[model samples]
Target: MREDAPVWELEAATFDADHTQALAARLGEQLQAGDLLVLSGELGAGKTTFTQGLGTGMGVREGIISPTFVLVRIHPNLPDGPRSGGPDLVHVDAYRLGSAAEIDDIDLENTMDSSVTVVEWGEDRVEHLSDSRLEIALVRSEGAAVTPAGDFHHNDPKDAGGRDGVITDFDEDDDNEERLIRITAYGERWAGRKPDLSVD
Candidate 1:
């Protein structure tokens, strides 16, 4: 089904973590169940910060930390929140997963229809998860890197075959940092639909 869907992309520049989150919130308002977001970027590039914004836009419960230790965390939508109604947020960390098989081992399909799944460090390993998905890559400005919430020096992102940054926890305390966020939608699920990513 994705083969017929034309791939389209949107790019934006953010001056701080909150700015990045605000943009993600706009995109998050457009997402629903069966949606998948695969994040890719270097360390401290604001992946976690972006997810936090999605939670806000989706009206999910607060405290959306990175799934570093637990590997997976679910944030259910709130009845009294901003959006009022939406699917839960399924946050996943694919850093330790070396292959697609490992990704399947987590059994995400159980909630695939009930939640919006987001995976960090899933650049090359999440194509099979869904026929249609949103692939987001964050490029941080040089000399503006912030410290990741988790200690993730396992492998240098610059030398890891150009895969992506390691999975780390959410960091909301980072100083002003510029990030170029590119969002690409694939598969027929997004056919004829253009999302509004404009945010203040």
Candidate 2:
């Protein structure tokens, strides 16, 4: 079997959704047009949350949501932002796509050169679209409970309350769940310009 290609990797620990987004935002500042980001992770792993940060950092219009049903959503850069002359943000959810041909059908190449395309659940399926891409994987840290995407739910009421029947704010405790994020850069585009993941 062929070994995996050499890659630039960075491991980060993020607490809560906001922290994950902040990290992504820092990374987004380093991105430019024609960039492809492949995000791989399980459900409720903060994939969309990260994209939200990227959009914000890119100075795209607000309201960045998961394009689960629509399959793809485009957010244009602000007219006067730093990315004004750069590409737009193309957020894609490939969870429903069955093959790479289906991704090709989207004709992403049309905007590939002028946009930062981010594909969720697009690990093996979308690599063919670009020779160089950034691959990000988010995983829940050990002992951390999984939180729903975009929304939070309380844990067991019993756990939140003592025998005296006092209600506690689960959000405080739940927000501490840390996520292990791995970023890998592939191909020549990232040869000398690997993202600086040192930022907290």
Candidate 3:
């Protein structure tokens, strides 16, 4: 929890989409304006699903869909006064970008100080924007099975410690996969306090 520590890690396991969203909501509770979360995971690894939970937790407008085709989507908070006085949500999808410069071209810094920016496929590309961002890497569990409809099925019972097994790399085209989410916090913004990823 040292402020100067290079990185601090927290891990969690999610059995299904509902569990994954619940976990994201917990993390969202700790978020505030000026926060940046860089997400990395294969397609169908629940990146967009997690963001949906985050937006809901933040009390932002609904319909938080993937920004893949559009590249970025902004969700303004309700005026009723949300956590930390209604910070906006800036969701970005960097999968189609060729370089970090393209991210800069989006003028995200203009809104960085007042919005919680969550970038998918932005691990290496978006780090330059903030030194105090969170890096979340998700993987599908090996025990995940395929359903008759050709979708992945994860029926493992919930594990309290969220440390069922080692997570490995996965295919981008995999569908309906269960995820093992690893979150790493960097810089003083997240020094002592860590997001609670435990499912509620």
Candidate 4:
């Protein structure tokens, strides 16, 4: 975190499908071609949800789903009208990878100049691909009590009914469910000291 780097934090009261769309709309306005976004979070942490918002904001194909099974999905803008500056979006999911080398086999770097490349589960391994990049990490707060008990398996004794059965109350400090998102700007395009923008 550079002292001068523009950064802002939002304490999302609740992390749900709508928050994902809002974040995307905010970020979509600030992005341009040749930018890379690295997203990291655990399963069901809403990485895909955020990307869905981004896709909607970027004017790429709508209904951008997680590429977990497809590996990569390219959302191209329709060329029907007078759209001159629209850029394609490339969504990649690297959860199945064992190492950085495996990610390289896909040659994602080559697409940066032509599209906004977003990699889900891409932190640690994909940052070097660009001189400028954005990293987003998401975490859920336990003190907030946002998770519904129904979401957990009732049969598990750890989650057994009574208040006494609860091992530990979900606290932001104690629970690992908090969501954190980091966006970094890299490359010559972002080297001019522009405001760190969320793009909304």
How many Å off is the CA of 19 in candidate 3? 0.6
CA shift at 185, candidate 3, in angstroms? 0.7
Computed on alpha carbons, the lDDT of every model, listed in order, comes to: 0.77, 0.75, 0.77, 0.62
Instruction: Tell me the lDDT of candidate 4.
Output: 0.62
Tens-digit lDDT track of model 2 for 116-139: 999999987889888889888876
Candidate 3 TM-score to native:
0.80
Write model 4 residue lDDT over 1-200, tens digit each, in one string.
45324233222323455655665655765678888888866666667777877777677777688888888899886565223367888999988876788789988867879999989988777766776776666555444444321122113222322332222333323222333343444455556444323322
* Residue ranges of candidate 4 with Cα displaced over 4 Å: 1-15, 80-84, 144-200
Clashes of 3: 0
Model 1 stretches astray by more than 4 angstroms: 1-6, 143-175
RMSD of 4: 10.5
Angstrom error of the Cα, residue 103, model 2: value is 0.6
Q: What TM-score does model 4 achieve against the real structure?
A: 0.68
Alpha carbon lDDT at 2, candidate 2: 18
Candidates 2 and 3 compared: the better one by lDDT is: 3
- The residue ranges of model 2 lying beyond 4 angstroms of the native Cα positions read 1-4, 144-176
C-alpha TM-score for every candidate: 0.81, 0.80, 0.80, 0.68
| Better model by TM-score: candidate 3 vs candidate 4 | 3
lDDT of 3 by residue, 1-200 (tens): 45434456665667677777777877787788999999987777888888988887888888998998999999998887456476899999999998999999999999999999999999779988887988887777776542221122222223323434435455545535567776777888977776655554
